[model samples]
Target: MRNILTFLQESNDTAGAAHLLKTSAAPVTGSSGLSGKEIFAQTCVACHSADGKGAFPGVPDFTDKNGRLSKPDSELFKHVMGGFQSPGSPMAMPPKGGNTSLTDTDIQNVIKYLHEEFGS
Candidate 1:
């Protein structure tokens, strides 16, 4: 019975190895071991656009030569996590860029992506 169980486990491992070899999984990249560009597209592009250019009138264009990320990382992090709920601006940055589940590391990774794609 033990030998049978061992054989089954080995077979499962071999099948998994074969599947991994046959299938394609893009390697993780960028800071935080995630695709920052992909996360931005999924979470931020609604306001920041695919190229990090702000789409709405109130949203600040990240691609601008003078953008918010040019500020210190601390400032950017506060804005992203706490959100901007000031008066006169209809759209405030939702906490954690609206993904409340994102960790500080994830937010930092997004900031890194912004620096790479938009910052001077």
Candidate 2:
């Protein structure tokens, strides 16, 4: 639709997709006010798309049960909070995907969203 195209083009600016996501009406997830999909749209989508597959090399695929999803939630939480660099990765994932505005609950919600949408 024209709306999606508008959003994609506008989102190319400094604001990125955060502006579009913040303005959308998505259901909340878990105790976090934002759904994982929402948080992802705001933060992670730059590198991790809706499929849970990353944009760069060494980015783990969420849909792969034997991959990153196998890690415990606590570890994933820590990685999201503190940032992570996988071996052989060209770059590291900055803390909160470089979005400092994200809160603890938001990270939790995104992780849960990953599990629900991509985990087996």
Candidate 3:
């Protein structure tokens, strides 16, 4: 997760981080020390999708360099931790993606994987 933060700072000086935090998962409870990819697949894929393109409108696409991935890790963490209400969207992301069993480490790992997979 720290790597993600440094990368964001180095990448573009975090121009639209507030928006990312505002845009930022599920209850599969990938709590068995799941890898980031596994967690994302089990939980986030329903929305963010495996290709990093959002599965639906209003969801931010990670493949977009200027989109959600541009945000710092802290903001991303807060976004995920608290869940977010995308303006005007009918649904909101639940905290811990509603898993309730995921530790903070799990989220960190998932974030790292997200960057590695899509930050390019």
Candidate 4:
């Protein structure tokens, strides 16, 4: 696992391997209390993009006022934790954005970041 992580980091694909390590059931420690922004950069930027404009067609544009950010936190949290298929769109959000290692708090922090950074 360490070698895989090293290789991913060297190849600038840190998120892929990090997601694998993070989703494992083993307890994760020494995270340096990463803030929501840092967490998003590390875990979400690959698909969501740095500006919250999703990288693919079906991925929601978070910066859009009429987009997913309009939903309440409860709804958003559920979607983030359990995954969601947006109506009329082919995109499907994987549970925990495909990172099961994230705690509820981590998800909440990301939600907060989304509202603060992209909410209209």
Best candidate per TM-score, number? 3
Best model number under lDDT: 4
lDDT (tens digit, per residue) of candidate 4 on 26-93: 23343246677877776666557779997545668999998889988999999988887777654456
lDDT of each model, Cα atoms only?
0.61, 0.67, 0.67, 0.70
In angstroms, give how far residue 56 of model 3 lies from its true place.
1.1
lDDT per residue (tens digit) for residues 1-120 in model 1: 122123324645443234334433333233244566766765566556566666445667777676676788888888888876435544466666556556788888888888998876
Q: Would you give me the overall lDDT of model 3?
A: 0.67
Q: What is the C-alpha RMSD of each candidate to the true structure, in Å?
A: 15.3, 7.4, 12.1, 7.5
**TM-scores of all models?**
0.66, 0.71, 0.72, 0.70
* lDDT string, candidate 2, 1-120, tens digits: 123224345535323334444554333233247677877876665566667887445677888879887999899999988888888865566676666667898888888888888875
Indicate the worst ten consecutive residues by lDDT in candidate 2.
23-32
Error of 1 at 84 (Å): 1.6
Error of 2 at 21 (Å): 17
Q: Which residue runs does candidate 4 get wrong by more than 4 Å?
A: 1-32
Give the TM-score comparing model 1 with the true structure, all chains together.
0.66
Model 2 lDDT, full chain set = 0.67
Q: Report lDDT (Cα) of residue 4, candidate 4.
A: 31
Which scores greater on TM-score, model 3 or model 4? 3
The order of the candidates by lDDT, greatest first, is: 4, 3, 2, 1
